[model samples]
Target: MGTKGMDQISEKKRGKNKLKSKKKAEDVVDDIAMDDKSDTKHGKNKLKSKKQEAEEHEEQLKRLKETQAEFFEYMKEHDEDLLKFDAAEFEDDADVEAETDLEDNEKQDVDVAKKVNEQKTITAAMVDSWCKLIKEDAKLGAVRSILRAYRTACHYGDDTGDDPSAKFSVMSSSVFNKIMIFVLSEMDGILRKLLRLPATGGMKDTIMELTNTRPWKNYNHLVKSYLGNSLHVLNQMTDQGMISFTLRRLKHSSVFLSAFPSLLRKYIKVALHFWGTGSSSISVVSLLFLRDLCIRLGTDCVDDCIKGMYKAYVLNCQFVNAVKLQHISFLGNCFIELLGTDISASYQHAFVFIRQLAMILREALNTKTKEAFRKVYQWKFIHCLELWTGAVCSYSSQSELRPVAYPLAQIISGVARLVPTARYIPLRLRCVSMLNRIAASTGTFIPVSMLLMDMLDMKELNRPPTGGVGKGVDLRTLLKVSKPAVKTRAFQEACVYSVVEELVEHLTQWSYSVAFFELSSIPTLRLRSFYKSTKAERFRKEMKQLISQIEANSEFVNKKRACVGFQPNEPAAASFLEDEKKAGESPLSQYAMIIRQRAKQRNESLVESDVIVGEDSAVFGKNAPSSDEEEDEADRNEKGAAAFSSSWLPGSDSKEKEAEEEEEKKKPKKRKRKSQAEKKQVEEGAGEDDVVEDFVFSSDEEDDLFDIEGDKDEEDDVDDDAADEIAEPETKKTSKKTKGTYKTWHKNYKKTKNKKKARVA
Candidate 1:
């Protein structure tokens, strides 16, 4: 049984092995099949690619053959066209040819040479005649062919000594000019027709050649005729939508300007007139041409042209008002150039033009009809004011122009009102300069009161009275106020100081009566404050130096011719009292005493009321009756006895006198309360309580007992405690406070305050 099992197992193993062998053989066969399939697919793709490439090659060959055929056909057509023209048409007639041959042979030639020369001449003349005939055909193609033939004949004539061909030699300027004139005149219609066609290569070459020659000198008349004709052509072209013509004409005119100024000027004038009357499209071109002409001719000639333009527009015809204004503006720019020149000869004319321009501008400004001045000169009004201001300020020696002072000032004030923010420093400077000049002029100072008043009224009308005023006042308002307008307390202080400085300076030279009285009359407190506060240190120094110089040169001051007046009454002792009162001080009895004493020293008459002695006594010391009844009579008798007792002995001060004096000394001083606005400002400042740890005491305040003793002990304690807390935060806060305070104080502080409130809220 075991043997049998072993044999069966071997058989099973063999069966399994056989199956494995069969599977391997089948796998190999499938792999061979896939390889063969892949080969077949690759072969098919190769065949397809070859077929496409062959088709492409064949197509390329076909295109090549077609191109070749087309080229040959074109050549054939051109050759046929060339052959169709008979050579004899270009030749001279038989009689002329025979006479030329005989003359050539008779002069210096062998018979054969002469015959060859005659044949060459005949051929050239034939070419020339053919070209002429072709040009007459009036076709673009025919004309180009004729130009080519003429060029060829001219080229061939360089080597061949042909008598008729000699006509193609370089023509002299005069001869060439004449030929061009004849061609341009007689063949103008034909040329115009040709110009409509696309530009041929030959046409461009010929134009360039003609332009470069000296034909301008000899052919000026013809050139003018051509230019006139060109203008007509340009008009026609413009109608037909040919902008190139206008551009070409402008370019040609630019070149022509250098050679023919006078002619160019005439044409330009005509063009300007046409432009003025013609379409708006022509205006830009005309303006450009005129600008170029003006630039090329320089300023003098430009000025002349401007005058001419003005005459042409304004004086000659009844131009449309719009057009007339346009022309005026066009000429107005020439003033800039005229102002730059040294030629005084043109000044009168220029000034006249400026004045007229101003009138025109004024009229335009005041015009009821808006359309009348819509396109009128916009900048002229500003420039007119500028020019007037400049002129008034520039000629300081010309005092005869003093009459213009008020008018010019009025104009300046008006402009300042009109355009306060105009970006013209020179204009602003001109206004300043004019003021200075007016001040220096030997004329009465024109009170700018009305102008200033107008400005102030305008400001008030613009702004609400409850709101604080604007930061700066206009010059007009400043003039009217006869002082600086104080918008803020700081500004009021500054203005008052400035005014005081001016008044003090004026007072040192002239009398205080002259300076302070006029200044003090103005209603503005700022002006009065300025006059009162400023110390005349510089003025005093100047006066002292002047007095010393006068003493050294005593002869000049003492001379009879020098009209000296009495030394002005020492600034009227009463004036000081008035100033003090204006400064918000009480009227003191001592002020009256000083005044009376000065009057007595000067031996001037004084009124009793003008002097104050105590509260009830008059200056003459006569007893005045008391107005009280019986109690007044008793009190008066007691006071009178006390007064007599005090006067009897110099050292006698009774108990009643001492008591009265003590009561007076003990009386409390009245303090004025700050306004709500001022109180608010102070409270606001205190609310921003940013304490500085490292407090620095000012030198002036260091001597205070509270600051030295109390502050030092408290500061030391705070410093010791703050050492535990980082100092950096306190330092930063203090720095922020300082920077913020400085910026807020220096800038528009009120606006900043409002902003700060908004931010905090």
Candidate 2:
């Protein structure tokens, strides 16, 4: 049994060995199959990667070709405009001179010959290398090529279209921006070194004279080309940001502008366009550039600048309303400040413009035609008057602009008298306020109380307000109101309030004078008579408050006058309380401030309410009440009133303004007047808030229509000796006309004027 078991075990072991060998053979086949599959997968991956690499390489080549073609195309288009841009001109000047043996002009021509561009294509790597080279040595000959390329690139798509006016910027804005950044940031320094110009602190006159001499002509030609091209690009640009950026960046080059008169004039013209019409930020930078140019170029180009700015102002202010009023006022103030730079030069411009205004007024009066009246009644005329008035007031202490002030005041006063009726109270008040400004700035007494007092006597003030359609006349833009709305209580209230405000302002301007007691007598009496006689309780209250302030101020001045031991003719007596802080300490001024602050708060509250109502209406639907909607509706209604007024008033082009009104007239009378009560309520509220803000809340001395803030620290360097020469005749007249208090006021005013001029110097 043991032997049988051993034999069986051996057989089983042999069978097991055979099975293991077979299993090992199967495992080897499986390993071979797996290897084959892995090899196949590796081969496919390798083939795919190779194909991708080939495609990428082709793409890079194609991209490089496109870039090269684009650059070559740009060069082809603007090659003529680029100086020293051709390859043939790169020959050594000494070699050309020796080989040609040319004359002086021919050798000079060789000096400015077109330069060779080392790199034919403008690739990324090539640009980088060029930048590196420029950084290392700004005086490299390659810089001219780089600059030419930059100039051509900046205006890449501007002239590509068949119509040169159509701009199709195909190149990305990023590329253009990069070019501008590189050039603007580095070109000034590079140019200064290349032109052998000194640092910016060097005298502009020295630079101007240096640039004009024989040695600097070649450099000046290059600079002029560069600057002219830069200005041309600016002229074509419409983006406010780009214009602002260009002006700001180029401001550093103003010292060089003195050498290029035509370029300076062109730049001034471009800047004036922006200053008058661009966004606020752009306007600021544009004005800064213009100021720099004015300083650098001096008086040679100032007249043209002044005229262009005035024209710009007129053109921009054609459609003045409350929203743009402040901006317009700011522009005017800046314009006056610019004028203060070269007062002697500006005097002629001011005189010319003021004369033009006067001639227009005179023609209007003589012709008595609608077209003539239209010229005087428009926003342009009003803004022009405001502009010159500000110019006068700004330099009131300087005799150079004093002569313009009188005629400007006359034009304004004539405008006030042109339409001597209750309907044109706003225009009349505007004229009076301008007069008041001139009077205050020059410390002279002007008879503006007559204009304000005249409004109180008009039938519009005494009539009870009737129900009116839409927001009662926006007296701001209303030259005339022929609608029954003029008879409304809201209009009456606004009219009376405006009159009272102007009266107080006119009185306040002279409240510090030695003759204040005398000046207050007539105005105070007229105000008292109007105050007691007015029927409206609100108007009466306003009049009473103003009268009380005037009386109190009169008392304060009288007391100060009583304490004055010196004669009224003495200089000390005339200069009493000339300091701003001391002048602001008066009860009248304190009251004015309080009224202005309160008015400001009320205006803020009204604006917030308007905004809230606007938001709610937007959230709702068309039927919902909205402040913006109400304003639009009111605008239409006022337009209708204007159209209606134009019909009855002789010389008005009634057909034009009546277009929108014709549609409204077709509606039922009841519906036409449906919102009369609502409109009246709205107007009453708005009038209560706006009248005070318009009149009492105005912080500046320029115009009641717009509040213009002056820059007290504005540096307008004046020639003191020239100023004295100009003021000599006026000073003699003042000395002759003055006897007691008037003479004292003149002496004090003269002293203050000298100090102010000294500070400016």
Candidate 3:
């Protein structure tokens, strides 16, 4: 206990001392942390207070400066003479004389200003006098006074109080119209006089003519005021004719638009509004003026022009039908022409639009949600695809625009595949048509045989038609069938006919190529399979005819290809039938024409019947005539229209007789039985002719057919032989190598390669 206990005590004491020191150190650290926290809080608070005070001081100073400015402006307006001083007192005699002359001129200007401000109304005579002064002496004073009045009048109702600089006091509507018309009409001549240039000088000449002279400065201010106010007035206009008139006049002054960049942009915005929402005549004039501005201003305004025009087109094309389709087509053509003006510049905008479309499509594909799908599956988006397709292909021969075509085609293909079912057959057909157009223009082959063949396998085709006779839906105007209209025989017939027509078109586009046989083989075989399996006699007849026509075209191309002396490996072989003019029309053109005519006639019949039904409803409903005679007259008119429209259809005699019998008998039971019999006939395929079992190509032959060259995505320059090819089915092992290659082009490969290299490094 002596030594051991002593060591134990020493150890215990040391432990206690360490614990006390550690606790004290912890307490001191806590106190120091609290003090530092409080000090930082106080510092932040002081800094914030200082900031607030400084901000408040700056605000007060700003308010004081504004007050001083307002006071000075008031003084200048009320008693401007008091602001002037005699600075020439220290100068020589010549300077004094010159100052005296300047004072006299200032007095004259004040007199002219007073005279202008005193006039309350602008009459025709006053306008004529001003124009005469401008024309005779090219007077800068007249220009300034009139432009000031015009600018003030444009904002007539904007302010509550009067403006001292206004030349006119009360600007009536008629007076404003007169001044606006005069300014727009005479702007060119006035600009020419002010710039001291001839009529034929370029915009650069006009801009260079400006100097430090007083007249030039005054002219600049006046012209800007006139142009800016013109845009303001144009924005408020609702009259289409007047807008057109104004645009027509303003287009002549586009040469000077380059000088005022901001005002020019505002004017383009206004023009785009009318271009989208105006009447046909108004839109035409607006587009013409836009084209002029793009040409006149060149790169300065072209970007805005293209972007605005595209936006307007998208907004307006949200609801296009057969009636508005022609106008939309014209707008698209005009847009394409505008792009062609500067393909290099247009490439940037085109790439953006194409990439945007691709991104939206990618999102839709990724999420597969209705909300996401709705964004891409609309008339606006479809028209956007067509528009960019035309734009990209219009300049595809040029390297600047060629790269965009592939990406745009990929977007179209993605949209077609987004909702690949019978319900979206019309949409699929539309996308395929756009892809076909791109391929045709770019000398690249897109294997759309799968899309065409997919349409044939839809279960909607084999389903029996409903007994009720509904209105025929136009596939061109619809993306998908509605619930009520989906079961109708008219939609079924439309789907079948549209599929056949699109297939024919797809084949015809590549018929003049060297690989026409390979291109037509898969589509032809699938169509035959569909023809044999389908129950509709009308559909079978169409498919059979289409197959025969495709075969004849293939044989025609084979005969042509057989006579060629060049080897298959040579460029001459690739260039065979490259010149379409020399290749003449495809063999399927006549068949395509006949199909189109029948479709047109069918649409006419549907429209007329719809009108008749609508009129009949109105005659028997609340809008019915009060007398029997009026009712009889309406019935007669409807009958006449129905008869006239029925004549457009095939077998008009049978339809006329049926219509007459229906009119004679008011029995519902008889009509019901007649509809049942018609339904039975449709179910049985009553119009069946001889079924041709011998197909042009067997399944074994299909497998042995030459492997198509197809499109490759490894090169920027598209090959000539890559014009047309039939891709193998996706399930085949060979297809794995070729998967998506036909759908894509070589534009994006290099980009992805560089990105991968960067990531690896």
Q: Identify the leading candidate in terms of lDDT.
A: 3
How much does each candidate deviate from the true structure in C-alpha RMSD? 40.3, 33.4, 32.9
Error of 2 at 13 (Å): 99
- Quote each prediction's TM-score: 0.24, 0.61, 0.61
For candidate 1, lDDT tens digit of each residue in 366-466?
Answer: 75243433223223344345444444434434544434556566555544433322112123333443444454443334343332223222232223222
Model 3, TM vs. native: 0.61
Q: Higher-lDDT candidate among 1 and 3?
A: 3
Deviation in angstroms for 735 in model 1? Answer: 64
User: lDDT tens digits, residues 358-395, model 2?
Assistant: 89999988987656776787778898898888878768
The runs of at least 3 residues in candidate 2 whose Cα sits more than 4 Å from the true structure, single-residue gaps closed, are: 1-120, 158-175, 201-204, 212-218, 255-262, 468-474, 563-572, 576-585, 601-761
- The models' CA-based lDDT, in order, is 0.39, 0.64, 0.67
Extract clashing residue pairs from model 3: none
Query: What's the TM for model 1?
Result: 0.24
Clashes of each: 8, 5, 0
Q: What's the ranking of the predictions by lDDT, best on top?
A: 3, 2, 1
Pairs that collide, model 2: 84-114, 84-115, 465-488, 465-489, 466-488
Deviation in Å, model 2, residue 549 alpha carbon: 3.1
Give the candidate order by descending TM-score: 3, 2, 1
Alpha-carbon runs more than 4 Å astray in model 3: 1-119, 157-161, 171-178, 204-215, 466-469, 574-586, 603-761
